[model samples]
Target: MNLLLNLILQEKQRIDYMLERYQEELAELPKGTIAEKKVNGKTYFYLKYRDGRKVVSQYVSKRNLEDLQKKLEKRKHIEAMIQSLEEEKRIAVKVLEG
Candidate 1:
């Protein structure tokens, strides 16, 4: 039982560190979703996100759209990992307590 408890404690620490790192990465990555608009038969992209109390939309040129989209996708993946780590940490804590 003691060995199992020690392992759980170690796993909890690892999860905590991973959660912190993922959160920091998430903060550095781009935020918001891409919005497509058609104007005069030409399609354009915009990066739409909320700023404070207002919704902000910034035009994204074709050249930068791919890079921006990649960054947004990375951000989403990291966010999901953070959530999973949090849940794991919660379970670890529950195990430690019991």
Candidate 2:
């Protein structure tokens, strides 16, 4: 049971590390230019840039950012849940032995 708990802890740490990497990558993206477009009767965000030829990223609106945030939160929540379950299992093993 101790061994199992240790493995679960390691997995949680790995996911946390990956999440940090993703956040850093997102932060490094250029601000570029902002444009508004109506799609499906809702305004959406678009980022445009020029090097030699113009470049545009697909719409990345506030709603999209919020959705990403929610996903990250869910990932973290799962990691925490795994850790909690591992602890619970360890405790149960101890109780049964006693």
Candidate 3:
């Protein structure tokens, strides 16, 4: 039926959009944590990440702290959106099949 065809096309477009967004959002992720250390009343910041079994760290300037945090949050949000898209794809597939 025309309705089913339209539904499939709309779902396909939505999936394509989500996939493109996923790829773009991946670049926004900088998977790491900002850590602080205090030494002799002086404070220091480090960006912490994992490499296999070992943990790696690098210095993060105070000026860049906010930017990194926003990137991390964006990455997390994208991950959640990807999961939601998976469910949408499943339903769409089922609809197409039935």
In TM-score terms, which candidate is top? 1
Task: Summarize candidate 1's per-residue lDDT along 7-74 as a digit string, tens digits.
Answer: 99999999989988888888899899999999999999999999998999999999999999999999
Which stretches of model 3 miss by more than 4 angstroms? Answer: none
Candidate 2 Cα deviation (angstroms), residue 58: 13
In candidate 3, what are the lDDT values of residues 7-92, reduced to their tens digit? 78698679978878897869657877889999899888888989898899988889998898888888888888888888888878
Candidate topping lDDT: 1
Q: Report the C-alpha lDDT of model 2 over 11-47, residue by residue, as the tens digit.
A: 6566566656655554554544556788799887665
* Candidate 3 clashes between residue pairs 3 or more apart in a chain or in different chains: none
Candidate 2 colliding pairs: none
- What's the lDDT for all of these models? 0.94, 0.60, 0.84
lDDT of the structure predicted as candidate 1: 0.94
For candidate 3, what is the total of clashing residue pairs? 0
How far off is residue 71 in model 3, in Å? 1.3
Candidate 2 C-alpha error for residue 23, in Å: 22
Worst 10 residues of 2 by lDDT: 25-34
Q: Please identify model 1 stretches exceeding 4 Å from their true place.
A: none
Candidate 2 similarity to native, TM-score: 0.35
